[model samples]
Target: MNILTFDVEDWFHLLDHKSTKSEKVWLNYESRIHSNMERIYKILDNTNQKATFFCLGWVAKTYPEIIRKIIDKGHEIGSHSHLHQLVYEQTPEIFKKDLECSIKTIEDICGQKVIYYRAPGFSITKKNIWAFEIMHELGIKIDCSIFPSKRSHGGFPSFKNQEPVIVSYNGITLKELPINYYTILNKPIIYSGGGYFRLFPYYLINKWSKNSKYVMTYFHPRDFDKNQPIISDLSLARKFKSYVGLSGAATKLETWLNNDQFLDVSTADQKINWNEVPVVKL
Candidate 1:
């Protein structure tokens, strides 16, 4: 079950190290996703492919029809936090409130209980493992937050098993469908999504997907927009992370989707028995 997912945030929501200093700039950009979303919607509609879209609560609130359109078009909707803040940066109380708000807002708009979540910037790391327990308390059933290996921002490097694993926290069990990774020379290497998917050749991703049951691929709306305005005064690492690959990402992704049969997280979950979700060892 190769799964293709999307992190549905506007381009600007992606925080640069410079931008993190001031979040007030975030409100300047309103509805930065329509054009790219239309492109993606048309592409998916033409190809007859369905995916899980982890969208922002604020976006869903402003454009309720977009959520309906996603449901009507036969895709699953999941929660990507309301404010797009990193999990490590928030206190547990604030984190839980944001999770609840996001779920509530999306559910109110879409008229369905949002059960899945993907943290902003893949922010679920060892330091914030407690957040998963908070999610389970909020009735979230699945999380696509844990990117297998470490990145500059945040990730679960030691926990990069590169497979769908159920992680039980407290007495609650939530399925954690982590991002894809490859084992190279007795080391786990992450090669899915973000700049990694763009900078490296697409064939390598296809090859990696062939080895795993599910290739969890994710892209932001900004990935498809080459004309997106450049962020001024970004750090060196942030510049590379945000703007490395713009030319052929969509085409490469389309090629992969055309060649293989993949399932969204919702569909794949339906096929499995959730009566006994795994308990993550502490």
Candidate 2:
């Protein structure tokens, strides 16, 4: 099954960057969320697609209309966090507080409980496995934050399952849906989202998507915004990774959706049988 999802954040919500790091700095950028989101909504509409939108609490608070629109359009909603930050970098207390704030903020806007979460940058590494307990404590039923391979910001490379699995940690269990990876020369390579999605040509992505049995996709508004302002301080490699192939991203994705059948996270959840899926202990 190919499940569609989006990280509901502004173009400026880049992770680990000094200038794009926090709430205060966010105020300094141009608010391009509305325009970017319109493009996404239009794509979904045109393709007759339903997707889960993992949103930031700040986005919910700053523009409640976006939350309302997502619900009104019949899409699933999840938390991306209160402020976009790498989860492994945060203390358990900080992560919990931020998560609580996100749940509260998003719930306040849409009047529905937020039970799904995707951490910024898929930042829940082995070092921060305790994050699962906190998410379970706060009522997140399904987590989409495990990359299951090595990543620059953070990734639970030790995580053994890329498909839907029951993740248990310290006596707490939560349903985890991690991104599927392509094996290249004995290494797990991720090509489903962010820079990887943009980096590879659509024909190759389509080929990979066809080869994989289960696919979970993660996209951001900035991925298609070719006109987005570049962060001048970013290193040369980071800049290339962040901004590569923007001009064709939206069109490529539209073509992708046109080619395949996809469903939202909630629907994907319903399709899974917890009775027989693998259980991973973190």
TM-scores for the candidates: 0.93, 0.98
- Writing each residue's lDDT as its tens digit, candidate 2 over 184-257 gives 78888788888999999998899989999899999998899999998888888888889999999999999999
Q: Write the per-residue lDDT of candidate 1 for residues 141-172, one digit (tens) a residue.
A: 88999887867667888774566778866676
TM-score of 2: 0.98
What is the lDDT, from 0 to 100, of the residue 164 in candidate 1? 73
Model 1 Cα shift for residue 235 (angstroms): 1.6
User: With candidate 2 superimposed using the best TM-score fit, by how many Å does residue 44's alpha carbon deviate from the native?
Assistant: 0.7
Displacement of the residue 214 alpha carbon in candidate 1, Å: 2.7
Which prediction has the highest TM-score against the true structure?
2
- Give candidate 2 regions above 4 Å deviation: none
Return the clash pairs for model 2, or none: none
